[model samples]
Target: KATVDFQPNYDGSQEEPTVLPSAFPNFLVNGGTGIAVGLATNLAPHNLGEVIDGICAQIDNPEITLPELMQLIKGPDFPVSCEIRGIRGIEEYFRTGRGSMRLRGKVEIEENENGKSLIVIREVPYGVNRAVLQERIAELVNEKILTGISGMRDLSDEETRIEIELKRDARPQVVVAQLFKLTSLETSFSVNMLAIHQNRPKQFSLKEAIDAYIEHRRDVIIRRTRFLLGKAEERAELLEAFLLALGHLDDFIKIIRDSKNRDEARERLGSYKFSTATAEKLGILIRSQAAVQGDRYVFSERQVNAILELRLYQLTGMEQDKVKGEYDGILIDIKDLLDILAREVRVLTIIKDELRVIRDKYATPRKCPILAEAGEIAMEDLIANDAMIVTLSHRGYVKRTPASEYRLQGRGGKGLKGMETRATGKDAPDDFIEHLFSVQAHDYLLFFTNTGRVYVERVFELPEGSRTAMGRSIKNVLDLKPEEKIAAMLRLERSTDENGHDNTFREGAGYVFFATRSGKVKKTSLNDFRNYRKAGLTAINLEEGNDLIGVNLTSGEDEIVLVTRDGMSIKFTEGVYKKPQGELAEGEEPVEEDSGEEDSADEEGRPQIRPQGRATAGVTGIRLRKDDYVVGMAIASEETMLLVASENGLGKRTSFSSYRALRRGGLGVKTLNVTDKTGKVVNAVAVTEQDELMLMTSTGQSIRIRVSEIRETGRVAQGVKLLTLKEGEKLQDISLVIPDGEDSPGDDTSVDASEGESGSVTEETTE
Candidate 1:
């Protein structure tokens, strides 16, 4: 809290007092509360020097208004970055006194070595954080508020980076100036007069308040001046009326000296209105008389002396001087009031001027006539320029062409029919008519007539070798007549592959036709064969057009096969076929023939074929065919079994116990190895109880075994015992048998005897 003493005048006097601890200056103590009371105002403290200067400037030249003061003085100089707002009522407040202050941040700038610059901010306004700033920036980016700034590149604890890629070259200072001028970085303060207050619950309009205050002050001055003037006029009128009523001095004297009361004294002068001289004498007498509470008139010594000394005429002059003094005071007061009113009016005028200047500086007009006119003039200026390409649109359709190129307006001026019609005569025949014209791929084509008639014959052929025309329309060329077509003049350029064969070019055919612009037939040729082939030339179609289809081969004879679309084939031999040969290619190999019934040693020195089968209980022995031989044997339970060898392997073994486990049709026991005369193992054998076996030599040759008969051995063998048969606790020697039979035998033996046990044997049985 601070105290300030204000003395209206520099010289301190008893009458001109000093105001101690003025509430006006101490308004900052409680942060300056303000109340707008109707026309009156209460503006809080501003900077002392600025305020004083502002007031003095206004007083010296009353044209200085509050807004002007604001422009000149601004606000308090705070150490921290701050913004003052809500001061819209400042003019009225200065006139009456009240306003508000809001604080905010200041924007700064920093530059880097890369010639890049960034806007820096040290502090933010009260109640605003870094997040708020970022959010605001993001919102602006989305809304396209901040132009030239692409977006916020990075935002962290210390700083934020905004991406400002300038569209054009701009100086750093110029860019910064633009940022401050157009964007919110520098200033985002708004003066809202609608701040709440205790006394003025609602907002105050400055104009309304100032006008009301001025009117009220004017009325006060007028009323005070009128009252003083009315009093002086009444005094002058009374004295003049009294002078007219008084007749003589002696009559007035009798009334003034002998009257017990003012009413009696007034009656005694009856019908004798005081003459100017008599009224003067009465005025002196009245002046000498002291005012009494009752009927009695008392006179002081000074009054008695004044009565004795008074001349009747002199009294009149004195009375006139008193009236004149009252008029003079009123006049002086009126002049002072007028001066104050003039000062206020001048202040208001200055405020208006300041507002006008501020508005002109900040609130610029939206539309610039110069900018708008530039665009209009540029558009009108478009004409023939070599570098400029023009797109002309008819209806919604547009075509691009060079600035001065000519294009075909359709026959009826409907659509693009041919090239450079403007260069050609419109009366030319359709054959000679070209609807499209170009200079370097800039096509000029007419689409419609002025009468809106569409010319169906209109065609637009894109220039050849145009990369941009890859998927564009080629409908114009394809509509040409058979012989008149450009295709008719096109020859098939044959190419050969690495294999010395010509590339296929069967597209052209007699039935295929190309047309010219006039629908006339152009030249006709075999080049159309390529076109026909691409149109899905089938075998039937190929045959129908046989004269158009030809084959050319460089090497091997190729029979021309015409395959129809439905997969049916027609073959035609065009040249002789030459055979290719080699001995190995014939699949021939040497093999040794077998001698009838010869006992030959296998690769392992043992007989290859084996015979084995089930025998009846009463049958003590069995026989085998010449093709069959003994291999091995086994016994189980009450059954005695024999072993036989065959081309494949050992034979079957059977017992009452074995038969119970496996019926007679099941596999029998057999040996896996065979013995020679020296009792050496020559081969390994495997057999089934179903009379089939496999014989494998030690040398790895294998053959199938089949059983024709089964036999039981009464004793063990003397030379080599092929296998020991076991029955319960007893061991028995089993003899192998070979059967002699007539069987068809000369066939490649890939079949295994074990396959027969599985019911897979294929053989003829004889009785």
Candidate 2:
């Protein structure tokens, strides 16, 4: 034992224990935050049971790896019933003793009495005061920094219940995500492990902290065993003295009666000696010590005092047996305590056993669940990856509804209203749905503007809406230039091959085809658009007074089709191959003409139009007559039928093989017979009978017509009226809904993946 002085007041007090004899390692269970001279510790608390399990595991296997240790102690377990998002911080903190983890309040979406969605906060992040958080939310709502929240109220009692009422048009999922982003509903806990060791402060890793506790536990167990053994042995000796006195009780009583005083009795008793043979004869167990010499047992001053002080009742016949039994029990206790002190493993086993008792009585279930990633609450985490029907209006409003909302309808049926029209305060005409898209929520949405810039985002980023809702302004979603309009969009998983070619879209399509209103066509390597800036990237360079009208993902070898407003259409090969390239990718074949031989070409075949740079003016694919303009372009497939729609709502499906292939830069033959009544050809795409056609008009009306209903006809056939457009409405665009598994680098199709799966992001890196 070491002596130390601690003065809490003017009066001094001295005490010492050398080191504390703790019952268990409480440092990890009840973690602390404190600071001293140049040292501090901000330890996160852990579950008692998990911590004990980990300690036992370490005791069982000192060589356990961090991953294995983590199996027992998953991470810090906060007392609050909130969510702990992501395990990355847990891993970092365990390995390095310094990291952070995200925490979020639990929220539920419910319908109120008025059928409007309401948000309820059930459990908040650790260390956050409910009152303060509610006050903060109230301030934000009052100031209008957080929109869509119409009202809020607190119904807190034993458990938290903060209800936030939403506007009729607010999306519950988006509002919940925004609350996490803007409030203490989401927070983080950081760990920095510092501790006192051997009277000095030290920074510690998780494993180091565990080991230190174990070593301290070892010291405590050993010291306690020594103290216990000493006391047990000391009492066993006193009992031995009592039993020996009982062997000569009458003589001892006579001596005590004859003694002149207590001191005399003690002196006489100390000087007396009993034969060792007497102890054996009486069946008494005696430990030979300083009080015993040679073969005789001479009473020590301590033993004499103990014998003299014994009460008459302890010397009675019935009590003698009790004294003997007590002595025997103490002897066993001494032996056990001695054994415990002798073996380190036994001490550890005892420690483990006691810890189990604590665990069984006090441990609770973990309150926090860990997520897998370390980013903010992403929509990808909440929304399903199912296909959605996204509609865009002429005035730049956009929204996505579940695709199941639209049922199968026959051709020539006037479709239900998909979006409500809203006029601008500046006297701009009321808007109508101009673009209809079928895309998986997780697909990459590339937005190309008439100004030649392109922006990319996930399909789920579009605001979710109910049927007939006009939706949020596109300006709030995308950073667009003045006078810019969304000309086209492609939902493709973008990636580049080792050769820096685009390969994710339609199997092996490695280029992007761009068409302008002036009959200009360009094909640039698709990889060139990878990893664009948030401000967007230049997709195509347009001539003065020209705008981009069509954009399609293309295979370098697919046939290119350009249709003009003046009824001119052309089919030309993207490239010419005299023979197979030195080597081709597996499951791929070289592009060849219709002769069915790799080296042969037919008279109808056309040469491949070489790709052009992004900034350069593309070569003319058609010679448009005065007042004529290119309206649509597509990567045509001979196996698929091409559907062409006109401004006057007339459309026809024709076998792509019916059209003769033409060379680039020419006055191509007419695919649709256009007259004043039929109007100009507006849009065309390669589609199949199983696919559905989404045709939108200039006045924002849309119709979904079954491709099978419109039977294939010969090229140059006069189109039948597909839909009766009201007064001024004319066809503006066409989107083909090919089922999943059909689009690839070679298939030349568009739209949607599997339904009911959450969206995934395709990350592309470029040098």
Candidate 3:
């Protein structure tokens, strides 16, 4: 068992010091375990800042409810990611002031292209050994301790990937549901409340232990504060008494100065009789004859000097001045004392307020009295019937009966004596049984057989709505305060005969059920139907007469439904006929006959086509060619001659005299170019604004010239003439020729000479 102790002390200075001078308790955030006696506690640590704020909030206002605290605290701050179960109990424990920390994993869902989704876990809880945890899960599956987990095909130290493939027609949400329901990606911790004391043999909850310590400390502080206040008051009183004594001395001196002679002064002072010592000191100063006068007791210089020399207790005994000064100093000291007292009082007041809040916030309400018909049984009769009764209180105690008292009658009955015989010899078996039955601040009751089969009727007070249990009025039990119900229940019973060995009555199987408001019971089971795979009722068969429209299948459970366009339905089981892919058949097209003959030429000599041609392409003089280089040309001359050329002799030419003529011709040119090879000029007059020239060489090379940059050369070729043909002139078998003085055309400058001819140049240039 691990123990943590926080002992604080003051060094008479202002600072309080921590006693445990080693490692602090920060590891608790990650998760840790401790045990004391029969109880043990596990801590799942979270974020430090969050934990501190939670503690401070409780300190500020102890009455804050657990739900409210959870809102402020949010979830655990785990280093690794994980999920926490049983969080509903967390608040109750904290209010009871006995909760451990928790770390949870982070999980999210992502969608793939197929409309299928996968659950992705990005983090795990702290202190969970990656490799070992995975290995343990694998072992559990292999050993059949866990089942219905199919997709754990592989696992690494850090991650486990599950199988997520879905059928072609399957819904994606169903697959996601299965992944969460069937996997070990989620887990929980059950807190086993525990604490230890060096002087005691028992364990305690954290709240009980801390409350005891705080109360003890509060008492100590109150006692110390009262003692300090008493000391301060005593010193103040002594100073006030000294101040009064000083006032009497001042009165005696005034009387002596008014006397006429020493004799007169003596007689006057006697009327106000001072202390003997004070009277003597006054007489000696007044009796000096030379200083004495008739009305004011005045004397000569020598007489006054002699009077001043008279010893007044060596001048240190002139106590009036000393007392007066001391009184003023003491008054200042008292003021400081009062200030300290005021601050201490404020601190106590605050402490009281905080304590009151804590009491109101976390305190459990008294149990509501239940009005069930009382029943009893004799100890001997109960033992004869092999029955055991248990009771619990708000305090923590448990007791039960020894198995030896039961009369065994079944095949597996080696009798209650068997359990007693197997019991460890540490103490009498009966003592353990008695301890189990002794109630000590526990909130539940249990009744069972020696073999550990719980008698549900004997334990739970059935509500009026529970028809199965005789419809007993259990509303009072259900309404019992939060602190009244037990946290959990356990039972001991004889094992089944599956082993096929000698019949020996050991502890049998037990089941735990959670009570719900609707009178429904939830339980943990080895055969869980909630998981997608184990629930065998998958498909609902909806025939033509069946009324069910939709069937909700459990996750990972496949269902097939057959339906006609007219809405008849039928469901198929997994073993039944598989779904067949549906297809459509081809059909013939239909046509409509005209009601009357088509119209002839109208009075204006224009023919009109009937609606019969509506489905046909209506354009004229244009055809859809597989490969035509569509080009738009701007006219440079009054009429431009155009050529169309392509590979494999797919070429033709048409002539147009003007832009209007070209539009009417609707020529489809095969190629257009903006630049020529060797970047030289040829037939520059033919170039026009934005006109693209196309030329093809014999070796299949193509060149383009931009007509906008043309500079006309005033020359023409004789053999291969460059002529400016106009007004729809068309030429064939013509080639480009360079001037005589110019350099001979190289391979790079030679025209393709494939198309019929090239046009001539005009002696015109644009600025």
Candidate 4:
């Protein structure tokens, strides 16, 4: 009790404490539950150390705000090890002292030797009776309200282990959800921190609770100091009397020996007078006038009695010095105690010091975990946030590995063997890596088809496989026509707008760049294809004999590079591509005029490029020769290095600066000198120094080579050999994989390679 004030008990026979002074914020630290006339309180228990820290913060700075206190004290920490979902309710409770807290029972799914699943309940919400919850669950199952329960038994011993068995065919998740709906698997508790203040019950926010505790501590410290100060003053006065009598030991002994009894000795000492000379010799400073009579110091009755009571040993020189020292110390103590009463900061400092000691002794790690959001978490939230290298084989098998699997190397060095491609079926042509790139599991992968259709699938939905294992077939995850093939794939991040709503397809983000094998190029607004349909969406309109060869997302500032099978490449600014004057009518065809294989000098060899609608054919991007078609299309910039691979396993890296910009539909200059030995250009892509290219052959042989390993040569030069292929094995496709943590390069493409007679190149082949 802080004070001695007491009141009569209910029967008026006994007295009771009016209040209990708590050193810690017990209302928050130990929590309580009570109800009175039209009033109730239910406070959740918090960490003791945290509560004290909050109290100390308030004492240190009275102006400390709520959030500052919250830093020391997180949301309520429960004793039982169960999850407390979200902080919103906790925040509201602390701010207004009343809110509902969401709580979930802890459970673990286990399996025995027979692979039968067992649900083990480890903990339950506060105030929930385990026996009652088990009975309720059994009752629900008996009434068929909860399904999938084959048997339920309380296996709880020392810990809260309630074993729940499910039917062989029953889903545990479904059963658990039903239990939560009917039983006490999940529950909520209302927090109301109502306490008595000034004889009136009042609700207290977190800050107010801590402030009240600090204020109480302040009062207790002040009261305690006043009491200590009185004791120190009395002790100091006694020690002064002992020292005075010791200094006049001879005179004291004579006075006491001359007395007939103890009473006479005490009376004689009380009236004993000391001369001014004797007072100076004794080093005693008499501040009271009553003690000084006629310029001579006389002892008071209290001091005289204390001196008379002194033992004989106290008269020794050593004892006398010790008494003097103790008197000096007691005087200092009295001054300090009085200072505490005169100033509030000293009292606060003492309180803080004591609290720190308590906190250090009692602090413990929290048992309950606080989730970022409340309610049942989606499965995706439990998955690891890791970037993966997703590789799709030519036969449509897909797998992903952690992006850290491959280490980058310089150009032309034998790269790491990432995966084996020899598992192709007999009917499959070659198991070469077709689509290889890095993306997070949560990203969206949009697959573009040769027939101009687009399909969307989450990266996580794709089966995970090891580096050497063939993954699950893409057909299993995505529905496709018998002969349909995915021509291009793009990864898009899940984005949110200002309101925190998902905006997967934000207008004005960029355009979807598309290119066809017939030297056709098209650019459609990305917003036009945001609505994802289970069936698919029409990405582009292709001519009768044309197939979409490449797709990428790009801003208008990118450079367009189109490489033809005849070793010709055309470079132009992406913004120069035609823009649609107005939206096209449904089923309307874009402008189409067949450009002859040979140059028609009078026909203005350049295309009058203009943007068109999604359901329209694209304008010519490159004029091709007979039997020669566009093999690759890439979005490039000044910092990009164009890696073009030939069918004969030959490739070279040429900087984008080496190519001159031209209007679309122009007959391009030679990019590679395609002779009898080098074969036709198979793949051309924009790659950074850190990128690695995985090349696959028709015989299922593949090799990874760093872009920097390949020689950088002139546009018209025949490149060096990239891979040593077996007889009858032609290069199929090239997939550029960017290393993790590396900056993204420009758009890339997979081009086909051809096999021809090995011979030295004499002159460049061009239309």
Q: Count backbone clashes in candidate 4.
A: 9
Off by over 4 Å in 2: 1-11, 14-20, 275-277, 284-288, 375-767
What is the alpha-carbon lDDT for the whole of candidate 2?
A: 0.72
TM-score of 3: 0.26
Model 4 segments more than 4 A misplaced: 1-15, 108-120, 149-155, 163-176, 272-300, 374-767
lDDT string, candidate 4, 367-430, tens digits: 7766535222222343565777777777787787776555443222333454566535569655
lDDT of 4 at 523: 79
- Model 4: lDDT equals 0.72
Order the candidates by TM-score, highest first: 4, 2, 3, 1
Name the Cα RMSD for model 1: 45.7
| Model 1 agreement with the true structure over 255-371: per-residue lDDT tens digits | 578878755654444433323344344442222222321333333333333333445674575665664455456445545544544575643443344434544454322110111
Candidates' C-alpha lDDT: 0.29, 0.72, 0.30, 0.72
Evaluated at residue 234, the lDDT of candidate 2 is 74
Rank list by lDDT: 2, 4, 3, 1
Q: Write the per-residue lDDT of candidate 2 for residues 45-132, one digit (tens) a residue.
A: 8989999999999999989998788878888888888888767788788898889888899887777889887889999999999988
- Per-model TM-score versus the true fold: 0.20, 0.51, 0.26, 0.60
